[model samples]
Target: MADFFRLNKVLIFGVGLIGGSFAAALKAAGAVDEVVGFGRSLPGLEEALRLGLIDRIGESVAAEAPDADLVLLATPVGGMAVLMQALAPHLGPQTIVTDGGSTKHDVVANAYAAFGERVGQFVPAHPIAGAENSGPAAARADLYRDRKVVVTPLPENSSVAVARVCDAWRACGAVLHTLTPADHDRVFAAVSHLPHLLSFALVHDLAVRDDRDMFFTFAASGFRDFTRIAASHPEMWRDICLANRAALLDELDRYTAQLATLREALASGDGAALEAAFDSARTARRAWAEGKLV
Candidate 1:
């Protein structure tokens, strides 16, 4: 076991959902001595403080970054570049910088360019957990428990820095997983991004149809469950979609082809083909749910 080091004066940029929840989790776990939140918005910082998500508020990234033992970037993916540039000069040699950005390749690449070898201290991570709701008001300290957190370390990353980040996630009750940045993007493009896109498209299609109200009235558990991701933040999803455009497009094309096959099977009343496909999917899903497959 690695010797546990309690973090001191952690600085969190962006006190919204993920950031706020992380601050609350670290505080509850007694892993950090003090949590300082910095954001462009004053209301969010006030709310985070009021909710006990953070101990103090930093007036600016430059003022806070140098003092933090751990600096976390929890802003939207689209804002990472700007934040990276702003904090570059202020980051101390010993500070470990990490981000909760959904996409890692671009964020990590930009960090390397901006901070050079100091980027070795930056660990890119994505906690695969969230609710439909966002902001400090919706933040919950227990949100990270049992969640899978993927950390992508570049060849230049310091082993000590990586271990420290893995320890932080472990302290927060997360199951840690390591992967290359490319692999992370490819896997999530299929499992996370594609499903969200399909859900939003399905809901939009229903809303524009003549029988929209009727369809919604009859919608039950399955429909509700399937479309739940459609309620996620539109701007965030839009950024994700654009960030992983190539992988997402490939997955979209494959999904469309499968949908076409199902459509043709239904139109032609091909019972045998339909039954075989459905049975295969059901067995696969059942195995997945039972943890029988990797």
Candidate 2:
């Protein structure tokens, strides 16, 4: 059989970093014939066209999706409802729809709402590769190389559709892992989402302090590294936080309990208790850093 990824046309709903990089990678690999971008911003679309990331730009996914063999939604998780509604009527029987949403549960719910029994056509995926920078200008063909792309296939999803999505990502040089939507959201909440929230909170807390300037002046590499994610697109993170609120809140509670334990240790001047807690965390982090856990 011919490769399903070698498509006649691929529609990218949001032609920014993730979408643009995907287009570039697939085009370079000869896995797609023509890539068309659909989005609200014409200027951004034009820039992507100029950068050779897309062959054309259209205003309506409903208008453009009918001809597409594949539709890649790279917009924020919050945009899923709109995108799904627009493309619902136009998706061909054989067309494969996938997304780059960081959180899967909400997007999967949106797909079920839009496509109903045909939700199997929409495969929910999250690419672990992300950059502090965004937009079409930051796109690179190698973005997914050696990176993990997690696919959380819904029960309604067809095996064929899931396999095709996996093969496509593999062709783009991504390592594929399969998980349930709940598992994907829970894992990401604990690891990615929680860290980002903490980073933003820390930066915001420091910013409002009376000695913010003085504190910043004395800050070093550790602070910079920890807070780097705070520079991420605020709107995107906001949407993610809301969409994955349940899982995130669970993680926050667990984290807060840990903090409370540490605070108790510090307040009681229990150096040994503090040392034990710190040592356990340090050892776990060191193991992960050495790729023993990851």
lDDT against the true structure, each candidate: 0.88, 0.89
Output the number of the lDDT-best candidate: 2
Clash number by candidate, in order: 0, 0
- How far residue 100's Cα lies from its native spot in candidate 1, in Å, is 0.7
Question: Candidate 1's residue-wise lDDT over 1-294, tens digit each?
Answer: 145658888988888889888888888888999999988889889999999999999877777788688888999888988888888888877788899988887787789887786778788999998886788998888889999999999787888889888888887888999999988988999999999999999999999999798999999999999999998889989999998887788889999999999999999999998999999989988999998973
Off by over 4 Å in 1: 1-3
Task: Tell me the TM-score of model 1.
Answer: 0.93
Native-to-model Cα distance after best TM-score fit, residue 17 in candidate 1, in Å: 2.1
Worst 10 residues of 1 by lDDT: 1-10
Over 151-224, each residue of candidate 2 has an lDDT whose tens digit, in order, gives: 99987788889887787777788999999999999999999999999999999999999989999999999999
Error of 1 at 127 (Å): 0.6
- Cα deviation at 246, candidate 1, in Å, is 1.4
The prediction achieving the highest TM-score against the true structure is: 2
